[model samples]
Target: MRVFIVHAHHEPTSFNHAMTSEAVAVLTGAGHEVMVSDLYAMGFDPVSDRRNFVTVTDSEKLNQQSEEAYASAHQGYAPDLQAEMDKLAWCDILIFQFPIWWLGFPAILKGWVDRVFAVGRAYGGGRWFDSGVFAGKRAMCSMTVGGPAPVYTDSGVYGSIGSILHPIHRGIFGFTGFTVIEPFVVYDPKRLGDEERLACLARYSERLLVLDSAPTIENPNTADYEGFVLKSVQDKHRGLD
Candidate 1:
């Protein structure tokens, strides 16, 4: 398997770094090719705009999607974006390693998504959900949370973890056509003892070994919807054909 990890933590000594390192070591040791994009280290500019493409569809106003479409047709992606797109195309499994900040991806990571997930290259023109541009690939989030598991539960203050991650899982990975793997989350890692941290790494290694077989979240079938609303829901008002 080929794995590409997009790491989004600034601190080298952080637990997120350890998770990424563990993934690279484990995957490489298992004979899988691995690549890491250390966003902070790379000094990646997360801001999306004309900076994403070398071509312009409009000069007076900025229409990002139009520019992206033009870039896709003209090979005009900025060198940095092109490199990231190449890796995304090359990988079988994509992993996002980051600390969950305020119930979502860090601004840098979110910006990475804004810039990297282009219209023509990633999704557009009836390409989304199961039929997205990355249809055959798989993606997973390896995240560390500041709070404990219970705090993220349905009845807890932070709400369900699954709901919290819906934007990334459903909107991003699933929309882009990657099989969404159940996230591997580390909660309150800072409070864990050395032994516990080591155990987490061991468990992560185990997950890496079974990347292909890992259980995945199901994506909505594009066939079931007319545009965005479910056909079943639409049928409730009108009789089914």
Candidate 2:
């Protein structure tokens, strides 16, 4: 499978960087194609605005969605943004490798989504969720946490990690029609010993090889809903991976 990994971390020697490097090495060694976008190294801009498009829908106020739709039709997105979209289109798997900050993705990664995952290209019109543009693809979040695993649990100080990542898994990956596999989270890498870190990398390598058979989080099927809400109690029984 062709995989696109977007790596967002500033430190080259950091564990986050190690994870991305390990992923590329392991995936490529397995004979799978891989492409990586290291946001910081690329000097990627996190801000999204009129700069996102070379095609202008309106010269006055900025309506990003409207402009995106127009750009999608006219190939108006700036070359850089369009390039990212092309990578997304080419990949069978999409992975966001980053350090979780404030319970979410970094600004650069978020902006990557804001600009690249635009209307008509990623999602728009009647296409979303199970029917979204990337319906056949699979996506995963590989992140490092600031705290220990226990701190991110149900009764822990930060609540459940699943709850913290709901917006990303459901709103972005799921909404865009990618089957989101369970996130691979490394908690408090700063606290881990060198041996532990090496073991962690080994574990990640194993995870990459079995992604096809890995457990996936369920996403609501559009068929089970009407007007974006569940149609009936029976609708709850049907879900898509």
Candidate 3:
């Protein structure tokens, strides 16, 4: 299977980078085609701008839908956006590697998403929403955390990591129509002994080798929500209808 591995950490020697490298080695050794996108190395610009918008004949008067449709039809994506879109199109599976910074992705990585997954490409457009570009694709996130696993557990300091990642797992990937997979996380890197780190490295390698074998989580977008009646009539028919 073709795989796209995106690494978001800036520090080359960071544990996150090491884990990414390990995953790449394992996947490549298994004869899987892997594409690596190191956000920092590429100096990717994450900010969205006016150029992203599709200008209708009279864009000023166009409603949001009209403007969006025009943008989608015109295909005015930036060169960087086009490049990432091409890579995304070529891959069957996507693996994201990053360190948890303040409980989320680093700025550069977030920028990669903001820039690459633009309107028409990731979302927005008439039929595109109903049939998202990423539909049927598989995605997983492998993250490193400075905090201990105990702290992220139910009885621990920070609720479950799964709960913390609901936005990304459900709101983002699910919203885009990709089948989300259980994330792989490494916790308490600062305190891990050499032996523990070695064990984690081995586990990471094993996980990468079997990544394609794991069944993808069903796309949440496939569920029928048309039966539920919203309290407000205007809001009732809104969203994925």
Candidate 4:
């Protein structure tokens, strides 16, 4: 399988790096192709603006969608962004590797999405949800959080882990037509003992190999929605009709 890992942590010796390193070794050892974009090492620009594209749609004003569509048609994206887009297109499975911060992705990782997932490229026109540009591909978040697992449960002060990552799973991966896999979460790795940390790494190795059979989060079909709202018949089952 072709795997593309977007790695976000700044420190090379971090647990996040260990996860990515383990992934590369295991995957490559299995004869799978693996590519990693070390964002901090590469000094990736996270800002989304005209800098994203080499072509201009409107010199007087900035309309990201309009500009992106034009860029998509003319091959006008900046070299860096275009390269990332190429990797997105090349991968069969996409893995976002990062430590969760403030219940979400680190700024650099979030910026990668902002800049790379452009209109007419990632999504635009009628391409979204199940019909999205990358419909058959799969994407997953392999993340580390500073808190205990129980803290992210439904009853915890912080919301459930599912709820916290909903935007990324549904809005980003699902919306772009990539099947969303259940996230591989390592909780408070910094607090874990050496053996425990190694166990987590071993678990991650197993998870990566079985990704095709890995549990996936279900997403509502685009066909069930009209104007992005589910029809009454569909909602009725949930008592939301």
Write down the TM-score of every candidate. Answer: 0.94, 0.93, 0.83, 0.94
Q: What is the lDDT of candidate 3?
A: 0.74
Writing each residue's lDDT as its tens digit, candidate 2 over 1-241 gives 9999999999999999999999999999999999999999999887899999998979998999999999999989998998899999999999999999988889999988888899999998878889999999999999999999999999999999799989889999999899999999999999989999999999999999987778899988777444546445346666431
RMSD of each: 2.9, 4.8, 3.9, 3.7
Which candidate do you rate higher for lDDT, 1 or 4?
4
Give the whole-model CA lDDT for all candidates, comma-separated: 0.92, 0.91, 0.74, 0.93
Worst window of 10 by summed lDDT in candidate 1 = 224-233
Error of 2 at 113 (Å): 0.9
* Quality of model 4 by C-alpha lDDT: 0.93
lDDT of 1 by residue, 1-241 (tens): 9999999999999999999999988899889999999999999999998889888879999998888889999999999999999999999999999998988999999999999999888999888888889998999999999999999999999998799999999999999899999999999999989999999999989998998989999888677444446666678769873
Candidate 2 minimal-lDDT segment of 10 residues: 225-234
Provide the lowest-lDDT 10-residue window in model 3.
222-231
Colliding pairs, model 4:
none
The C-alpha stretches of model 3 lying farther than 4 A from their native spots are 51-69, 125-131, 215-219, 225-241
lDDT of 1 at 32: 96
**Rank list by lDDT:** 4, 1, 2, 3
In model 1, the runs with Cα more than 4 Å from the true position are 227-241
- Name the better of 1 and 3 by TM-score: 1
